[model samples]
Target: MFLYMLIYLAYHGSRWIPRKQRLKFQIVNAVVITLVLVPQFYVIGRSKSSRYCKQPLLNNLSASIAFSFIASGFSVIFTLIEPIPQSLWASYHLFGLLSCGEGLCTTILTLTAKDCVKTTPELYYMSLFQTVASILSTGFFMVRGGLWLTKLNPGTDLSGNNESPAVPH
Candidate 1:
């Protein structure tokens, strides 16, 4: 899906950007998400005279918070259970994929439903932004996780094979 592509693109692009600037990138991501969502909710909410219009934004905010909690919990579990080579980047990617899946499902459900209709570009863009944000956030976290892992276990084989200095995943 398109969300997956954005995650991967962001994930790989992280390599080109300086490590120190990642936090700033994340901040920009947060801002973009907010910018995209507010207008989107307004447009979508206004178009549908249904009572549900006012609720989607609230639902989305709650969902985002819940998603963050769930993603963090899963990441912690993975860090403790999986022999993930101390690469937080992998975790970030894993988390990003899960988040993207959540966003993708949410968008698909919203667009496909006849009961709740979004009749404007504003709403569509807002949905698109959330999807993109989900992907970017995941990508950022994965990259950060990988960087952390590498820092934690430098010169150690995370892949469990002692043959190569670093096991290629």
Candidate 2:
């Protein structure tokens, strides 16, 4: 989402802009990231997220934290561009674009499969999971964004708001 774009500024920003500048891009990004992460960490503390995670808690915690960080990135983007533009930049489609961006890393790795598979066998398999997650996420976003999922069945938002997608008719 737009919240993710705050990071774009942070990473792709100019080397130095100033108090002499008006709404300096770097300062705005720094403030946005700081403000967004504050609430995220607070939520992590209050929620029993770790306790509910699967056993061998360590492994699951890692996944949970990673997801939280991802969400935080999205939230930062959202903060920057809230009252989201109503054109083709709707949530589902934007997330689809983000998901495709996520896949790029694995895509590059995939292109060099033999080297990784031989060099670090476990990582090769692990990257497959990342690739699949990226594809499925993108598919979900696209389906909803393109209205295909809604067209398939009315009153189904896929977020459990209306009749469940699995509900018996």
Candidate 3:
């Protein structure tokens, strides 16, 4: 999930670079984004035949896959549509919210496990930490999205507009 978030950030942040260089970077971004999902698919496939497959773990994995798919779809669409900055910002926040759902499922799974014999201290700590991080990230993305929306009009074409709304000096 963190990897996906970083990729999303890089894909969006590429807009800050000069246009001539942006195309090459975006191509690379798309490749990397696709590569990142390979391991996840492998994990899901391996888990399918495993005797220890549990509901919470499966839920977490499925949510993560859904988030990845949605992010990938949006990234491709953004590249084709060249949406405004406000849309990009909103997409990132939406991704963050989806990530929170994955984190919550993981936390619940970790907490409600009926069998402690298979669980370890490290697993518990990791889930707890991730839940906290996801909550924090959700808040951060929401605030950042709101700020961007306020600063940039959603209807404006940022691709061609050179002048942004005036800021008080």
Residue range 78-159, candidate 2, lDDT tens digits: 4344344666246534653554554664555555564545444444444555556556655554655678645666766657
Clashing pairs in 1: 86-149, 88-145, 88-146, 89-142, 89-145, 89-146, 92-141, 92-142, 93-142, 96-138
Q: Write the per-residue lDDT of candidate 1 for residues 1-169, one digit (tens) a residue.
A: 2333343443444445566666665554455445534554465455443345422543554565565444434433432332335575566556566666677665664455433434333444455566666556666657867978866755556674454356688
Model number with the top TM-score: 3
Best by lDDT: 3
Model 2 lDDT-worst window of ten: 52-61
Query: What is the per-residue lDDT of model 3 for residues 94-140, given as tens digits with 9 covering 90 to 100?
Result: 77666666766776776675452254333334444555656665566
lDDT values for all models: 0.51, 0.47, 0.59
The order by descending TM-score is 3, 1, 2
Model 1 misplaced regions, further than 4 Å: 1-11, 18-50, 53-61, 65-87, 118-169
Which model is ahead, 1 or 3, in terms of lDDT?
A: 3
lDDT assessment of candidate 3: 0.59
Against the correct fold, how does model 3 do in TM-score?
A: 0.55
